[model samples]
Target: MLSKYPGAVFRGALSGAARRAIPASFLSLRIALPLAMAFSLGLSLAVHQEACAQTDDEQTVKAIFDERLTSGEMYYLLEDLCKNIGPRLSGSEGAERAVTWAKEVMEGYGFDRVYLQEVMVPHWERGNPEQVRIVDVEGGMIALNALAIGGSVPTAPAGITAPVVVVHSIEEVEELGREAVEGKIVFYNRAFDQTVIGTGAGYGGAVTQRFAGPSQAAKFGAVGVVIRSVASNFDDAPHTGGLSYLEDVERIPAAALGFQSADRLVEVLEVQPDARLYMHLSSKWHPDALSHNVIGEIRGSERPDEIILVGGHLDSWDVAEGAHDDGAGTVHSIGVLRTFQKLGIRPRHTIRAVLFMNEENGLRGGLKYAEAAKESGEKHLIALESDAGGFSPRGFGASVDDDVLERFRSWLPLFPQNTISYVNKGGGGADIGPLRRETGTPTIGYIPDSQRAFDYHHAPTDVFETVNRRELELGGASIATLIYLIDKYGLRDEKAQ
Candidate 1:
């Protein structure tokens, strides 16, 4: 069990000096001249003191990086987690092992406290291989690479055999109405927008179809849905992600086709407008199963009641080893705590690392954590999440008010020349988002390079070997440095004015 208390407010230290009323009367020529010179000297001393303090902060940041680069354990820990535990889908045996392993590792690191918070999560298994084939095409049957979307309902024993209706957007499905879409398998061919500079932007632009297409098509009496993989790379690797079913509508089977497969589908449809598809999916959802959010903490020297959270989801999609999807992020969170202990940096606020469960298909872990925080009245100053893949560090994305954004921007110079140089406006992470929405706590997301993330995202190719050691360690150090700054200065809203 965990104990929670009321939120704590921090007050800034005040200067003891008071102004005297005799200043105006002492304006005589001789007296005023020496007074002015003394005041100028005092101003010079103050400026010098400020400069010295900045140098000390810079030195501390440098030390954090030095410790991370030379003797970092994140990469090794990641290797063990990936090779040993493998895929940790929530409620599965792998997920249970991961929970135990994470807690044990934190305790071994000698954190002040280590514990687990109970969470009930959805358990969905991708049972057997899926099948998708073009039945009535001109050149006969053609098999397409595919993976069932998480939480999708399984097709009947005979499977679904229906004519295909192609639509680019959900709006098109609506415009077609039930007459054209009924009893047909809707094919969503919206590809990733390559023109977007940020690959993440391209993903955001195209992912809506994968997440909402199934239910939207079901609304129009569609039998099944197949969406182009929400990926940038033009390859045969099919990307899988979670999808939600509308409670009021019928749940239909949904799957993603790789870029090449999607292109082939278009070619057939152009030649034979009456082409039909045969889809078989064995994915199913089980009853809610017990899980836990693995938590570890280093108590603050002064404000132990105040908390600064660093974390990533421990559970990932079951397809691959989840190395880049979140294995790197899990180790990155642990590395932040390890850095604090190794460097002997006792922060002013408690630093807690949370390995959230069930972020891939369901957000049960995140929802539970936020609920407990609300009920217990815990005061969280900020929550930082590293869900983005472990690529070269770009910067951070912050979900905070304008004033807080400016304050974070002021510390941009503390980072290395090209690594983590900016803080843009965005949601921190799926697990931490509820905490931000419930409380006013500021949230931050570590934004690594997005160019190659989709190539390995939720595919079989995402393995431990793909992650770079230096890049992973750098991400950890970046997170630690940001945490150090937050712990020292506090957030703009919480700090003394």
Candidate 2:
């Protein structure tokens, strides 16, 4: 069949070879004429095949974007997940409901398979609202906005009241020694670095205080710990994230004060330097609960054994609806599969969508998934995660070699201008990290605009209303396009170890 289009095929071969120009005058006429014709015939067939594949991929990607923009269902699904299911903290009724809803939705979509992978997840509850007050100062008692850190031990019914000792980092606490920190409440007032252009970078710089401050302060006999919220914006709303406790050290209650409240604490300290604080946190940890990693897949027609996975965590902090932290990612995963089915695009490699559980506090779901894959000998060719937020698409970050990265960068021009045009080397996400480490699966993280993500991260402001429909849909489309590309032309030299 290809022999009929000899001219077109020869042109395709010449186009590919043009990248590394070969001289035509090197060959003598008698040998060159016949040999060149034979070589062209063979090369032309291969070239034609390659060009056909590229054309199909281009058209498919365009169709994915069009379908997502015109009839995308992720926005409405997110509305239900956020408004109806609400916050899906691990072990909460909300989480159970979300699991059921996700399973049912995937089944309704008629995926080839839909199931759950059982996992034991930590269960932490915010028993009651937290209380923090600045006292023993010239201004009398002043209340400060606060929220208890996840996985923190509950304070006594009456709570603890002690003199406040402020410090910037854990190093400063060690320098102060036990004499100054003992029997006092340690206040970590390190603010997010404003100079960092990426809000995630700024969050990383200041998040240690929230995650490890309590246990570090406890080493010096501190009764409690209060950290300034790890947020970019200066607002009265406190951001709450998970805290870790050292087994060797005493577990003490910890909470995050809102940006404005931290500022007030600093002001009071400057004037009196002997301020006392009374803090009450009712957060508690229950026994580990059984959860499941919700999974759905569209089996590939050609290479069913090889898998491509995309996912996000289903759990969120208990404070808000979790519309962005991961609610966007959850629906985004589903949207990818939905778009494939809607476009009737049968993939070459099985595409699986996993909604991980307990990513906010524990990585049990991710760990369990990796373990199950290893035990079952399931092969994952590539994994991608979308946990950044439902914001404008900004390409993907990959934990791949230089050659693979270059191949991905070459496709940047295929994407729409100003949408998903960048590719960088980095870890994919918390949920996919284990898979990469355990199986050497190439991982990709969907990168989105980060300027506004931290504003509502782990706070009550991360609600359904904060997400934009266009931005969220665009993200879904971008993910689908990437998945389509991978399905068409699998990542460079991917092999399951």
Candidate 3:
């Protein structure tokens, strides 16, 4: 399937009348004066043309925004992914269905090419509902809403019951030593730092306890680990995310308690001094299974060999629909291609959209794509990712050299002041990080408003209803406009010339 190619450029012609031959003495003076005037006139015309091009860029950006805001299709696409297919953890039936669905949807849009790249992905399942409770509280027994961390080992059939030892950080567990932690449950009670302006920074600051706490506690001979939910709001829903276990340390079960439940546990521990808790998880690890990264593109009219990639992970946690975590990003990437094709805006560089698999539990898809690019000797112009929730646009965070960053900053005027106002340094997506490292492709992370991102990140509440249609469309429009600019004007340092 292909859209009619619109590969035409219009040029303005300037013609002048020829003059009769002159005498040798007068020829030198007449020729010099005309030549000097011609040079000045040429410079003025060049400046005027540059200004006209800049104005066209602004008008084009506005058109893209208008189309997306008024007649966007990403919202419906996200609905199908989040509602019909639901959670798509790698190696599961849902993940496979998502692969096929994405392929067909892109094909329907009539991209020039559509295909899949095979990748073996890690497979793990949350087998059953987790059972965690504060057994020794004054009230009969308080059940704490919790979820087993992805990639964690299952607890004993009968479950674990022991005295709870509270620690704010992994270092605190080290301070307590094996003597205090052995045969006990380590509760990592650190909460999100509300003082941080960016919620993402707060998540980064607190996520270490969830990602490394289990292994660190296990190193000190703890039987189990429990952590406060890495969430922005105080609610009954528990957030689930992947955990990394060191090879040398003993594998132990880990879970995250809802913010309110965590606070309840703290209150009990404060009064009782030595409160016992019970935790039972039914999570299991399966053999790595086959998956694929769905890819589609509208080949560049001029520079087909050089590619500009836009992508997001397709696999989400199995807890609930992954609307914000990445469903927004997946649709955003596809929307870029759809908008370009619908408007007949053939890019100058091959613009490819990738729906990477296995970002939730593992980065297999991203690594595979990068490896393939290197083997084929592919040249990537840039890679952009949208993993943040589908919120109103803010700007982008870039992982590029200062010259490239400056070049990107110059294009900010094309975008509206309310949308995409800044382009900061130091940001890239988990899936695209390998590509940047393997191929040296400059990376950009689409930054939406961070206020409500953590609220649904990795939680059951991250469903389709939480996403606002206008917000999601605006995010996609912002990405499309950026890609259009990058394709139109290459990322070279023009000032050097």
Candidate 4:
């Protein structure tokens, strides 16, 4: 390393002494100069080593983050993804295009290894436009804007047109009992509570009704299930999300009515005492289709056997552009890996980027991924998932033992300038959950403060325009810094104090 400094002293060395080699004094000068040079070199090396031992290079790691963030590729790439691919529902042609595009983009980035892991995924097709109409004694019929919830079957050629029964929650249906609910449209009337400071809290309170309400109503012998729009603000758009059916109970058609339609249904139900509804859905489930989990890796230098995992689900619900739900997440994950590559800051463990499939309806992608890792005898050091929207990052939530949690907590104070203080023990992510339960590898979730997420969470308003470019970049830097620390310092083996 010191060879480069020889040029600075070369001219002075050439100028020293009048004659090139005066016999007696020249020979003595040569021997003394070489000895002095070796001794000075040894002393200089000791001082440099001590300085390095005293100073931490955390600031340098953070500098890489700052520089890359100032000029990151995530926002621009996300723009093209949303503009071209639009919506990438699991089985749709759009999703296939996204797979190709993702593969090409990563290869374009010049990854050392770029490949796809094949995984079979459920293929539920949302057919042509669905129509829903409310019948009034005077008005006769009023068509409403609505969409069939994912995984719904077609309601015959004539369609399912039944009397609408508006219920506040699954509890209401339980109270109404099978007698009242049989052969009627069960409408879940729970609304997202906008008053909550953390809008994610409001979404958490309401999403359970969307996921489980369908099966719960099926238990009571209902013909179909309809939940009120899952949005904080009023709109005509019907938000669609995942719904699961119980094993023994019959599977009924389910849909989400727009906020306005839900309100009118209540009013019409009051006047007529019995208002009928006509809903026609055209949907079907094809056989499982082939999908891929795109994986990229950066090999470690020393402890290469240990692995650090980071990912975002590639499949999104087929409505809007699927921007905030996961497009933001997908791009953010890619950005984390790209940041390291651009800075030439190589991780000490194998760093992986896994774009999971079928996360919206089924966790088949995550399940298959964990199984493959276990089968291959790969020891996952830690897994981090980012599915929550790319709002400003708050901190990480871990599904770790107490000691591991403490180690993460110790780093929280380091993030004060970024206002990230909330590292704690919690569920990692839906996709990463199975890995934690099965592999015992620690998992972490990227959590942004939950304000305004529920407003556009699953609604059509969740377009690419909703993503804040600055906030997204900040989030990418935050995760990258965490990865740097974890890779440099191994995780705690026991519970946190």
Leading candidate by lDDT: 3
- Model 1: lDDT equals 0.87
Rank candidates by lDDT, best first: 3, 2, 1, 4
| Model 2 clashing residue pairs (backbone) | none
**Global lDDT of model 3:** 0.89
Q: Write the per-residue lDDT of candidate 2 for residues 1-497, one digit (tens) a residue.
A: 23222222345555666424446665687777776776677677777776675566668878888888787589889999999999999999999999999999999999999999899999999998899999866648999999998898988899888899999998899999999999999999999998998888999989999998999999999999999999989888999999999999999999999999999989988988888998898887789999899999999998999999999999999998999989999999999889999999899999999999999999999999998888888999889999999999987998888876876777776688878978988859999999888888889999999989999999999998999998999999999988887777566534422
Clashing residue pairs for model 3: none
lDDT of each: 0.87, 0.88, 0.89, 0.78
Q: Compared to the true structure, candidate 2 yields what TM-score?
A: 0.91
Q: Who is ahead in lDDT, 2 or 4? A: 2
Residue-wise C-alpha lDDT for candidate 4, range 1-497, written one tens digit per residue = 22212112233333343224334554576587875676466546554554453234346456755754678579888888888998888877988888888888888888767788888888898888888888776649888878888898777778787777778777888999989888988988898887887676777788877888888888988888778877777877788888877888888888888889888887888888677888888888999989888777787777777889888888888877878778887887777678889878788888887888889988888988888887887888999998888788888888887876777776664453764667867857777777777788789999986775666666677788988887787787778877877776667522230
Candidate 3 lDDT, 146-223, residue by residue in tens: 999999999999998888999999999999999999998999999999999899999999999999999999998899
| CA RMSD (A), model 3 | 5.4
| Candidate 2 regions with alpha-carbon error over 4 angstroms | 1-12, 15-55, 493-497
Quality of model 2 by C-alpha lDDT:
0.88
Pairs with steric clashes in candidate 1: none
Clashes of each: 0, 0, 0, 4
